[model samples]
Target: MTGDVDVRRIRNSSFLTWVGLVLGSWVGLLWGSLLFMPVGAGFGIAAASAMGGYIAVPLWGTFWGLTGLSGQRNKALRDLGIKVLPDDDPLTQRVGALAARLGLTTRPWVAIMPHNNAFAIGATRNSAMVVLGQPLINTLTDAELDAIIGHELGHIATNDMRRMGLARSFQNALVWYFGFSRTLQRWVRWILTWMSEFLILAMSRRREYWADAVGAALTSKEDMISALEKLHHKPRLSSYERHHARLMIHGVDSSVFSTHPNFLQRKRALEKEKYLRFVKKPVVAEEVLAAPVTLPLVAEMAYVNSK
Candidate 1:
């Protein structure tokens, strides 16, 4: 049931991948442009400058927001107490290897946080970072961790992380612009924001499913499922954890507005996948095999020899 677009076979080869930052930047810019968010807010932030707030704020926010997201990525992450691993770290090496196997030209930084959730953040693939919960990391197997990393990398690869960042920013801007009103204008703004959030949450849920599929394909169905199952819990949220709840990988939220799908739903979806499977003979294209070597030919040869 897996389509070619949905399930990409892991590739270990790429000629253009090794050429350093110039080529990598080109690739990232292309990917980033492809997934770029719009530059308009439902509740406009008037330009305090010459340009009206409606026009200028979005343009301004879109520009610096993306730039700041990339430039301050490390600082922002560290502020959350995420311990970004060094390049020489074993865990980093393992994740880097997985990124290579997935044919990712720009691998993200691997970080650990003292929370019960895993999530990815960045404006571009070049600046992407995947943060894992330390508790999960200390307890899970290497393969399982790879599965988790693969899913987060999927977000980085598709640039969904940026889309999420912008969507949330827009949501907050709306709150600021409309927060003071007490009349119909305020109520209307609230309705629009609520509707937008509902739709965004739906998209987020779908992205989670796709990321799970990508992880399963990049690692193994078993590892992804195991990782999800192991990390699934009712976490006593710290202020930081609760603040970034929407970005987290796993949660028990079953509401229509929940950013993530139910854990059991994710598990069931994974149960149907044949991704990143480990087998003596990995499924290869039929054309790659020697078509002339038929079973009947072997049987005929054996019969003649016996005679």
Candidate 2:
């Protein structure tokens, strides 16, 4: 509304691009590794070491990646002074309420982590977890918190979480090449890290845009814009090292090849389109509706439908 609202169609371009990057990198890594596989095998360390590297990279990456996100959620929750609902708590009842209102199948898990960020990830439509940073919770108000949660829900609704998880899995598998410590191995890791960092950054940027659109669609563009503006007030650093102190939860150290667009780029996008143009919620309300009321009903329906 601020300018022209020429929303582009979801071309799946970003998804495809992510896939290509993962696959290409995997193939290159494997092919290059095989070259040294012989040397490793000659010492009888090739089969075990190469295979371990192959398997270990993805496994380790997935484990730590998920662990890092969980850490972020814990940090954010603590900072926000919000209670994390116990598995059987009445708040679980509210899951359906929020999900139905947001038009999602499940309510994303809201947790805190130690960074200044938020993200959503899960394999199934019903299994989303939204992790937020402690800094974000401490810094933003309740309305701002809602807007941020809404944005993360947007990621779940768009299935970006699942897609991103897969991309990360693939990238992790390819990182097996890093297990060896040769000049070429180091060089390859460096190059691949550079390339993966670039691609991940790009994919993250597009997903950020898409998620912004989603939040705007569910809540209101103004809320999203307000949230972004709130973020703008926080620190902004140029280099990866400079930003690392704040990005602990997402563990999105650009140095570590994690998924995240540059911070400034994110801020600009929110500003460009007037972030709140698409959301439906008013900035202020009598009480923040934590979740929708019909949550149980929809959950039941979803359960029945699965049958």
Candidate 3:
């Protein structure tokens, strides 16, 4: 049974891995050629320039990956009022226990944002942080919360975070490579970037399915379904929340640009898992987890925004 589950997890991850690699390589080749061609022409060494262009792909990609872009993003989020919980805190402790149960040797840092969402962020598993929001805590029962946590952990366990980071870095490099040119090269870069995004979003949606499976394994399928239903409804946001939401990049239309699958689609996918068929329903109490220490600050910000 364990082996079969592992196989399924591996299959899902492998599919995304190949997609990212193919798209990244295609973008890198085009980006590298554009960047080096001019420099090569000026130096009267077309061959050297061509080699340099090819080499730049892997070189720039490795540099971006090692530079800790995700860590920097995490820092930016912290500056915007996200607070990291200490390991001894109740919520952090609970998440740590859950991580252990999921066979993780290192526990991810737990943080709270003032928004109404939960997400995982990090370049690697050891540095990963699982961020939750006040509204999510206020809205979900303990079992449902467990399911969400499990889903996030699944992202870490499957290395989806790192893979996505690498893919995005490739996309970023392409943007940088094309930033100054007014020629047809810029248009080409735009088209390539669009294509890359589609692949990246597809991988993201697949990862969500894998995470939902993990959530089902950790908690009951019913709990996962209930959590998805709750998440479907947008929680009332303070003006501060609204402002932040505006700054965040969201897909206005089309799943091709969205990082997550639709809620109903995710729920239905979880229902189809073979293991879930035999799993008994959970007897969850109608109690939500206590709000973290950051809740008051979030609430205060919301209150001030409303006023």
Candidate 4:
């Protein structure tokens, strides 16, 4: 069953990679032709356009896609204020055990920072590192933390960071190609930017769902859902900010610019019995009604339970 899931995931990733390559190539070609036309007009528009599309665009896109603009290991760690965990640390132990369970031959560097979230970073499987925030560690239980770590491992296993980097490179190429313009070209570029954003965000949301499934596979459906609730309820905001954040949680604002799906939507998806059954887990909704004042009662309950 796990083997089948792995095969399906690999196939999906391959499909997305091909789609990104083709789309990126086309976008680059269009942008390259526009820029090259000014100089290439001496050779005639048709020839210049062909040269830009066939040679310049594909070469540029390929370089960016393969090399990647982000994923600099040192820079990422430094920016996040991440410090490596000692071999004996419990978190490090947990990470090692989890990596072994996931069949990762090259274990990811485990680090911690002073924030409320955890994420994975690396250009490839061999270089992957997982960073957990101090607040996240302090707030979540052992089981909850395991579920969250599973999600980050899922990102590494699925190569989401690399895929997103390639997509971002295409977006950056578009931005650079259009940055010089001021009038109609600038407006066109703005529209294209939004289009690229929508596509990237769509992919990001799907990746999150896939990661959630991986998390469930690693832990339990209940544990994954509880972790999500704990993450949602973790207190890091002021009263006023919390109120506004709640509105955003309900998706009052546009999600076009957001990367992850709304938490409520994610929880609902996890609640589905069909998905739980597929993962060979029994589905049992632990009902926690929302308070009149506070929107998500599960988060409140989770907070109380943790206390």
Compared with the true structure, all predictions reach lDDT values of 0.63, 0.54, 0.65, 0.64
lDDT of 1 by residue, 263-299 (tens): 8888887886533232112446684565567899899
lDDT for 136 in candidate 4 is: 75
Comparing 1 and 3 on TM-score, the stronger one: 3
**Top TM-score hit:** 4
Candidate 1: which pairs clash? 46-53, 47-52, 47-53
Better of 2 and 3 by lDDT: 3
Better of 1 and 4 by lDDT: 4
Q: Which pairs in model 3 have colliding backbones?
A: none
**What residue pairs are clashing in model 4?**
none
Report residue 181 deviation for candidate 2 (angstroms): 7.2
- What is the per-residue lDDT of model 3 for residues 1-307, given as tens digits with 9 covering 90 to 100? 2221232334235345535564566545555455557543653453443354445555566578657645654665657678888989999998887777666768899988777667777766677888787777888999998888877877777777677766767676655555545653557567767887887778677677777777777777889888877766675445654443312211121356666667767778878874343332333344233534488888998999999
Candidate with better TM-score, 2 vs 3: 3
Q: Model 4, poorest ten-residue lDDT window?
A: 244-253
| lDDT, candidate 1, at 44 | 22
Q: What is the TM-score of each candidate against the true structure?
A: 0.69, 0.54, 0.71, 0.72
